[model samples]
Target: MDEARWIQQARAGDVESFGRLVRAYQTAVYNLAYRMLGDRMEAEDAAQETFLRAFRHLDRYDPERPFRTWLLSIAAHHCIDRLRRQRPDLPLDPGYLGDEDPDPEAALIRKETRETVQRLLRHLPPTDRAVVVLYYWYGESLRGIAEALGLTVSAVKSRLHRARWRLAQGLEATDEV
Candidate 1:
């Protein structure tokens, strides 16, 4: 994809180059937003804001780091801010699941599990939620998460531990219901 060339051109004020970059990363940015915000519309908005911020701060980006990491860092911070502002208790959209599951019962179980996880995620603080999403769903290493979230590796580890404990507590509480 000649990402370096595109980034160079984009830095030189080539809008088309920037557009290509957006198209390349749009789905990733949107998925991260959707997972963090738990609402399609809000996620869309957050993704747009993340790109806008990225464009505005392209000069600040370090070429030494992977562009995807930098882009997702912007997204994570934006979602965290949006979450902090409203803290909505919106339900996860069931439509997120694909129809590829041929077994109806298994599909139902997966849907229920997804909903339960999303519900538990909603109870976490915004930063903690971001840490959990980036770590588990994105399969990010502790160092990667720490870089993305602007935290120390130790802080990321602590948040993951705390988030797991809280999620376990949430599960127990739900089980009693």
Candidate 2:
């Protein structure tokens, strides 16, 4: 698929071209939302909103920058805004597991681990959580995360460092329980 051509067409008021872009990036956008919000429904909503915002603001998009980066930037900011509106201490629902694993024991362990990680992530400030999620889950570089989240590179590094410390503390507390 020629992403540049699609982007150009989308900019020229072609809805189908935009739909193709959405199909290509939906999983990435939704996964960022899911990791940030820790709720399947909210993540889905955020992903839709991100695409809507992107479509509306296509003219503002700089062609020199990567389209995926720009899209994820919108998703990250939307999730951060949503997080800010809600109570910080609200319990995170682990949501649902994916397809059944052939090994039941392994599946259970993986579920438990995912739940634990989500719980720990819930403690982070929204921006810090976004930094960690983009860095770890998406394998985004520090510079990429900085661009995505509108933070300076040093700020991104600081947030990542602080988030790790907080997550480690959370793990220790859970271990003691």
Candidate 3:
């Protein structure tokens, strides 16, 4: 069944239908939450909360809207709220979430690069991080990002600009250091 049919079934209290939706979107939802929260445990919790909230308010979802976008919006808003309630700077273990590959050297380089970027991203305010992640990591268009973030397109552009500038300055300082 298509997403619409599954959504309909889920809305009508079909556990199997809901399970399918969760399975289909779990990786994507988890990735978004992880990128937004910068902590695997916190992202897992946030993703669960995102799905629970979505299931609870499925009726409010507009059928005309894309389901993935709607789902991400919930994740984004949940992450933003959580970030607001906590400090953005919580130190992460350097060895956490290491990626392994056939070529050890290449894998090490990739891991270091990713760690650097994620570390810098942690310095950004939540909404700015959300906009940058959606626009760059997800390759979402400006208008699409605006919708996902519940922000105006202009606001999305401004946030992206400011975030990019901040990231540039941050990376520059890291280079100097």
lDDT order of candidates, best first? 2, 1, 3
Estimate, for each residue in 1-177, the C-alpha lDDT of model 2 and write its tens digit: 499999999999999999999999999999999999998888899999999999999999999999999999999999999999977776677655476789999988988888899988987999999999999988999999999888899999999999999999999988898
* Predicted candidate 3 versus true structure: per-residue lDDT over 55-107, tens digit per residue: 99999999998888899999999999998997655766363364568998998
Reference-based TM-score of each model:
0.90, 0.95, 0.94
Ranking by TM-score: 2, 3, 1
Candidate 1 worst ten-residue window by lDDT: 90-99
Per-model CA lDDT versus the true structure: 0.88, 0.92, 0.88
User: Across residues 43-115, which tens digit of lDDT does each residue of candidate 1 receive?
Assistant: 8999999999998899999999989989999999999988878737555666463656799899889888878
The local distance difference test score of model 2 is: 0.92
Instruction: Show model 3 residue runs off by greater than 4 Å.
Output: 93-98
Cα lDDT for residue 9, candidate 3: 97
Question: What's the C-alpha lDDT at position 75 in model 1?
Answer: 98
For all predictions, the C-alpha RMSD in Å is 1.9, 1.2, 1.4
How much does candidate 1 score in TM-score? 0.90
| Top of the candidates by lDDT | 2
Candidate 3's TM-score reads 0.94
Model 1 regions lying over 4 Å from their true place: 91-102
In each prediction, how many residue pairs overlap at the backbone (N, C-alpha, C within less than 3 A)?
A: 0, 0, 0
